[model samples]
Target: MTQIRSRPRSELFAAGVLVTATAILVAQFLTATPTAVVVGDESTRLGTVGWQFGLHDVVVIAVAACAVGASTTALLNGIGSSSATSADTTCSDTSTQESTDSTSSELLQARRQEWETVSERLASNEEQVYQAVLDADGVLPQSEIVNRTELSKATVSRTLDSLEAKNLVERKRRGMGNIVLLT
Candidate 1:
């Protein structure tokens, strides 16, 4: 495959500023007398006397400012570009997430329609909690079971314990919560 790259305006602008500053500093250093190279000295005034900022000092300060500006611009641009890169990754990931969500939703709906055909006899709360987990693609947090099934936390915990006894669900500790996985 033929690879192509695109450059952003901020990088190009920073590069231009860096190059210009470098060239000016180098040319001034090479062509000026040794006295002129001494920054902030009154010798640069040629005939003027006592405590004055000369042209050489001004040029050196301006060049330093440009170099500093270029580096800061590049650093800030890099930070902004990283966020843009993540946003691009999220846009790409959203499509795959939507497909997976839809497939899981369809499977859950079919299970809901056919739940009565199951061979095992489960309590109504157990069945509702199981359907909630199945709706979440068979992996869910225990706290979410309470929310999805509209049951109290105590009730959900008791139901989960009952389901565990029957080998219908398992709960694993995950940070501050338990992730319920269907067996």
Candidate 2:
């Protein structure tokens, strides 16, 4: 019998980044001083009352941003590299539907039926956008969805926004474009 391997359990890179960022943040806070440079007093001229960030401030901001981003990434896909392409990594073969070891085959069937039922109730534009992502196995680049639907980028974006608002789909930032995921 052929055995299927389950998803990988380690998000090494994201975890490392998170840990490093945490250390940096702690060190920064512990040593932090008044690093904000005030150009003028509170009652000074309108344009002269700006604050300039010193090196300490910039480092703190950068570390905080990195920590937030890494934590979000790890939390979302920490269980395994999400089956969704565009979250972190793409499937080795994007054209084929791979067996999901995380969920049983029967569960897959139920999920498919559930999606079909949901699709039936969506508006035309929403359905088109939703179908594009569904057809891509619950994840596709927003650009790809635009191509598949032959709809204007604006239309697809608007539809996606509506779908997201309904908690039917989610859009995640991926480089220049977003990746749409079925929720």
Candidate 3:
């Protein structure tokens, strides 16, 4: 599994610092004016500029500066949020994979248990079929066993093969059918 790291603190801090510096610079620029007119210089008093005065200009500059600051803050916050979301997504994927693996393991265990139960049932069925043949004087046709057990041909055939391999039954070919004898 892969580990996801959080957004770097330094990048967030730098963004904050940049926004703050921009606001400060905008404030300084808006308030800045030519030096005050000297009382002793008549020409300087007439020529020196004072703070610009206009309701519209002040409103426009203030609005523009605020918009810049707001947009910058929004951009930074968006980046941080996106990074956090990506990290969360990675964690979610890991959790999902773990759940899938656990489910698959559980399914495999269930299948193995089912196979064991089936094997036990098959062994029991084979024993019953063998006893039936012995009770019938050691000679029982495959059809009779199939009719008695109500099992499929393939299953009966496999069981008889297993019984023969165990030396519990002997097989003799007779025409198209096999005569099974309990040994």
- Number of the predicted model whose lDDT against the real structure is largest: 2
* Alpha-carbon runs more than 4 Å astray in model 2: 1-106
Worst 10 residues of 3 by lDDT: 79-88
RMSD in Å for all candidates = 17.4, 15.3, 28.6
Flag the better candidate by lDDT, 2 or 3: 2
Query: The CA-based lDDT of model 2 is what?
Result: 0.72
User: Number of clashing pairs, model 1?
Assistant: 0
**What TM-score does candidate 2 get on C-alpha atoms?**
0.49
Assess candidate 1 and give its lDDT.
0.69
Q: Which regions of candidate 3 fall more than 4 Å away from where they truly are?
A: 1-122
At residue 98, give the lDDT of candidate 1: 74
Number of the top-ranking candidate, with TM-score as the measure: 2
Better of 1 and 3 by lDDT: 1
Residues 60-147, candidate 3, lDDT per residue (tens digit)? 5676677567657656564443342354456557777676657655754675555344345546768667656655645689888888
Residue pairs in candidate 3 whose N, alpha carbon or C atoms collide under 3 angstroms: none
Q: Ranking by lDDT, best first?
A: 2, 1, 3
